[model samples]
Target: MSIWGRVFAAGYDRIMEGAEKSVLRAHRQALVGRASGRVLEIGGGTGANLPFYGDDVAELVITEPEEPMARRLEDKLAASARTAEVVRAPAEDLPFVDASFDVVVSTLVLCTVGDPAKSLTEIRRLLKPDGRLLFLEHVRSDDPGLARWQDRLHGIQVRIGHGCHCNRDTLASIESAGFTVSELRHDQLLKAPPIVRPLVIGIAQAKA
Candidate 1:
């Protein structure tokens, strides 16, 4: 990982604590009934989903590539009501058997993955044949001007805020990775001028 990524991981949980507690909570709440069985959370930063998981979920396994972020995730898991296993690994190379999980949850992680399609493929592999993949991501805007601005600012943002890119087409990547949309929605998460990102939520099932 880049030094900047490590730095960002160290303080990211603290920096985004409020947003996780506030802005992100409602969106996550909508997913309560969807998560169940053995759940695998890719890029499970600071175990944010631990608190939101449903009681029916038998196990929760989280993968986080960044060591510093993994530490935070461990700490949060310890404090959370949800019981979970934490793994320090990237989404592309998950250390588990195929079809190991019944539900795969990813929130705001695609933008940072070096290859979103590959990561999504890994998610598909981990999911059971009838399993669901639930996601919450920020995608590129449709406005030409905004898209251009995202392209312009992405490089700087990646340098400063870890590997977070502002313009990933997360929906397209998921589709290409062999998942079909079951439920989908798009909305704004922030009200800042120019609106750098639009939040996207979807429930997808394995192709089989």
Candidate 2:
């Protein structure tokens, strides 16, 4: 987990540069651009999605629990020339009131939370009745062979990723948490190892 410390924070952007250029950056643009009104983002790692937020957004707040990541995020926020707030908070324990936000953004973040289901429940609680959750995550593969690989490599990936699980059934978890996945795009995390490549991007809203 020390790797997820200062060293990871210092080199995080550089490490993901290739993946960002290959596929992630575009996906971020498409999903994050849709964010509007009062928005709250979980993790906000390195502020990678910082550049894509559209001007229609009424207010933007990002929470990051890790000190190392939060420091990096704050630094990036200082340089981004954008108007937003950065808070030191975890996904599973956000401080906002219920139904306070119109959008909750989670990009490449759900898999790494301390409690994915609980974190999402908090997201649901924070969102307004019609609010949206914009998410892009790598989940357990549908293929049995690949899923097996994901299972084998999951621990190693978590160690290296600092808490990221390579084999979570994230989409299913979202549905179980009571959100209706309104739009979905199945995709691959290009330029990554097979065990962690399976991906899904989508929008979900709380059920009535």
Candidate 3:
């Protein structure tokens, strides 16, 4: 990461902390019954999901690349009742064996991966044949005008947000990786200021 990249990530995380926590808190209850067994969460920044997870999960492993963010997650984990493990790594190239996890989760992470397709492929590989991949992501708008604006601002956004893109069609990417969708829901996260895009969330099962 560049010097400016680090600065941008720091500022971005700090600014979005409250909104993210709020959003996660609301959506997390839905995640409780799904995440189970050996779960691997990609881009689990600051261990925000710790509070939401239930006792059903046997183990929780987080892969977070940002060093500063990982430290913050350590602090969060210190207070968490769940026994969690943190890996300072990126989603694109995960360091784990094939079919290693029973559940894989990614929240607002696909938009920033170096290669979203490749990362999803890796996630698929890491998951057991019958494992599930659950995700919450912001995606490209269907509106022509809004999409154009997203395309235009995406360049600048990626620079300041450590490659985070607001226009990725993450659902399509997951489907392209050969996963079978089990359930899905979409909602608008920002209804006032940036009211154009919607949050795309889904739970998919790896084909057996």
Candidate 4:
């Protein structure tokens, strides 16, 4: 991993502190708390969702592609005394068998996947027929002018965020990935810049 990866991992929770206190913590508590059965969380950065997971979850597995982030995630899990497992794995090429999970959680993750379509496909593959996907992602702006701004500033955002695209149509991507969106809500990512503020929190399941 590059030096920036370590730096990013080191400062991950600190940088997100403001947003976490003001907005993200509540969102996570609501969404992640609902996860149950065998669960998988993709790109589990710094293990932020660790505290939110409930005892209802039969098993919890987290995957982080970046080495530095993976190490930090493990450390956090250790500190929290959570018995979850952490693996060094990317979203697109997860090293798991088919239908291995009853729920898959993605929080601020889809946009950073090297291939959103492939990653979502992998998530679909890992989930059982009745499984659900829980997602909380910042997506392309619904407003036109702000979207243009996002397009213009996207490259810089990628460099700063280390591969996260600020203008992805993640909601549409979920639908196209063969998941039926069962519940959804649009909200703003408060305490963050407007370019990446549009958020979508929802639950989806595989199409029958």
TM-score of each: 0.92, 0.97, 0.91, 0.98
Model 4 — TM-score against the truth? 0.98
Candidate number with greatest TM-score: 4
Clashes of 4: 0
Model 4 C-alpha lDDT versus the unseen true structure: 0.94
lDDT of 3 at 127: 95
Model 4: lowest-lDDT 10 consecutive positions: 73-82
- Expressed as tens digits, the lDDT of each residue in 14-43 for candidate 2 is 988888899999999999999999999999
lDDT of 4 by residue, 79-170 (tens): 88578988889999999999999999999999999999999999999999999999999999999999999999999999899888999999
Model 2 is weakest, by summed lDDT over 10 consecutive residues, at 1-10
lDDT of 2 at 173: 95
True-structure RMSD for candidate 1: 1.9
- Per-prediction CA RMSD (Å): 1.9, 1.1, 2.1, 0.7
> Largest lDDT belongs to which candidate?
4
lDDT of 3 by residue, 1-208 (tens): 5787567545755667666665645776686457889999999876667787777799999999988778878888898777888999999899999999999989878988899989999999999988999888788888888888888888887766677888887888899998988988887764222522478778998776
Off by over 4 Å in 3: 8-13, 191-196
Q: Candidate 1 on 64-173: residue-level lDDT in tens?
A: 98887888889888887778888888988899999889999999898888888788888998899999999998888877888888888888877666788888888888
